[model samples]
Target: MKKKILYWGILSAAVLVVIAASYATWNRLDPNYTCARCHEISTACAKWEQSVHADVTCTDCHGTALESFNSMSEKLNMVYKHFTTKKTFEDIHLTEKQSLALANRCAECHQAEQASWMSGAHSTTYKDIFMDVEHNKMERPYWDCFRCHGMFYDGDIDDLMAMEGGPEDWHIKDASQMDKPAITCLACHQVHHEQPRGMNYKDMDETSRGALAQKAKYPSTALYMRADKRHMPADKLLKEQIFAGDSLVAEIKDANTLLCMQCHAPGTNHQLGSEDDKTTIGDFKDMSCITCHDPHSNQLKTSHRNVHKKLFSTLSK
Candidate 1:
């Protein structure tokens, strides 16, 4: 009995020591250091070290998952990969839960902007797009819809919906995601963007600058490319000639228009005014989409929202 007790005690001590060491290491390990094992993360960390958000703690924006001891898939994934794979990895994608959690944190710093975004059409939830009765009946839901509506959604439409229920059934697999917005702050803006900060247009009086408050966003505008699982900066989007049959509709030369067109793509042949492309025509041809549409909300500017527009319309009346 004494011998057996001694052996059990020895085993227990070893286990305790291992647990203590692991907990300590986890607390002490810098996220940047652990992520350095992957080349892509290392490269991004190098940029972040010098970027404007350098002072901000990674966990603050990225969410507690980075430092969590919880049984989240990410923690398990990192550990499993460490043992099995070679040091380098090409892709390090965030799971939907982790991504959503990270996006929720942006509101902490950008309260007003976040509020405006929540009120915008771009902030549509999964239920708003996927489970719609009229639209689903008109067109069967498919993977392609994720390109615009749920760009940040980690899976295809089939994954989110119960296909077993047939074309008529639109049963969502996870009801919890019903309230979560498809397009998040991370959808349009890359936090680690290295560009100089946008002007503080909010502080400027409406008359001081020929613009309304919060009209200008920092140059962080980017589109999340589903194919690459990376954000392609707006300016880098290829300039293509839009056509209405043989008629040249428009040649996209600027980044702003190009950004919108990437997702609000033209028809298969790049035809204008087709496949959700609401290209303003006639008198509105010269006006930019942002001229009438509020950039964040993607809703039309209120009648009184723009002073110049209101004045011009009043004069015309």
Candidate 2:
């Protein structure tokens, strides 16, 4: 009786392992054909087939099955919904945490930029910003914080924390997001910026793609406006005037500068040097934000005041 039970158990275990392996293999081999049955997926797949990333596999960027634990949760959730409801994922947009998990994936192509951004202030993780004793004590956590930090975060500040009063009372609700940076590539860049490509688009080498990118006229740089629930293009963004007391300091025209001011905007009183505003005054009037604050790594120029003062002196000549 014991021998019979042991043999059956071993056989069952082997069968389960074989089944799991088969399922994983089938998922990775050719999911596009199955996915293409859906209209939106089909349209996206068709465009991707012609894009520069045609050679890239669907699962490479968007993780599915057992590829990544971070992505598996969401993927499995969506799959469960599809199986149970016979429904499609209507909202394809990923939340802030999910998107950040894919940030390193972007490094496969943009290594240099990724390294720079990782070293910058923008790389600050959720724990560093939200659970801060100093910051939270001063202002208290609020929805407004998401405007700049966790722009793509699906929930409000309260959803992330259980705050009673001080830092000691604060406990982050979702510990998984503690290590994830609130901002990511999607915070600034819009993928799929182009469609209907030139001939042999898939055959174009990296150098060719790099050359095209330099001259690319596409409006890809964007900012997430919580109200819009989407990243608004730089051109479409309204250019606001920065004021200093009674005088107007600067009116944003350049797309890059426009995006910067969207977050580093003037205070409620419409005054520069307030809130997060770093609007340069006096001799630096004509200069753009990117002139010093490199987007990849927003490292301030040496002794910011001295650097700009010298720059101003040079400009005068």
Q: Which candidate leads the pack in TM-score?
A: 1
Give per-residue lDDT, candidate 2, residue 19.
84
Candidate 1 residues lying further than 4 Å off, grouped into runs, are 1-40, 63-80, 87-89, 164-168, 197-218, 281-288, 303-317
lDDT for every model? 0.66, 0.68
Question: Best lDDT goes to which candidate?
Answer: 2
**CA lDDT for candidate 2:** 0.68
lDDT of 1 by residue, 1-317 (tens): 99999999999999999987885565456756665555646867765665546656665675444355663566676778767866543466656676677777877766666777878888889888888877887888888887777776777787888756545577678999788888887677666655432333334453533343222333446777766777776667787676767888677655556677777777878766567565544445534556666667777657625543443354335
Tally clashing residue pairs in candidate 2.
Answer: 0
Q: How would you encode candidate 2's per-residue C-alpha lDDT over 1-317 as one tens digit per residue?
A: 99999999999999999988886776667546566666445656765675555666776777666766756677678767656654433345666656766676777777777888989988888898888888877878888888888888888877888887667679779889788787788777654433345623346675654344333244436777766666676666887777757778677666766777787776887776667666666667756665666566777665464654554355346
Evaluate model 1: give its lDDT. Answer: 0.66
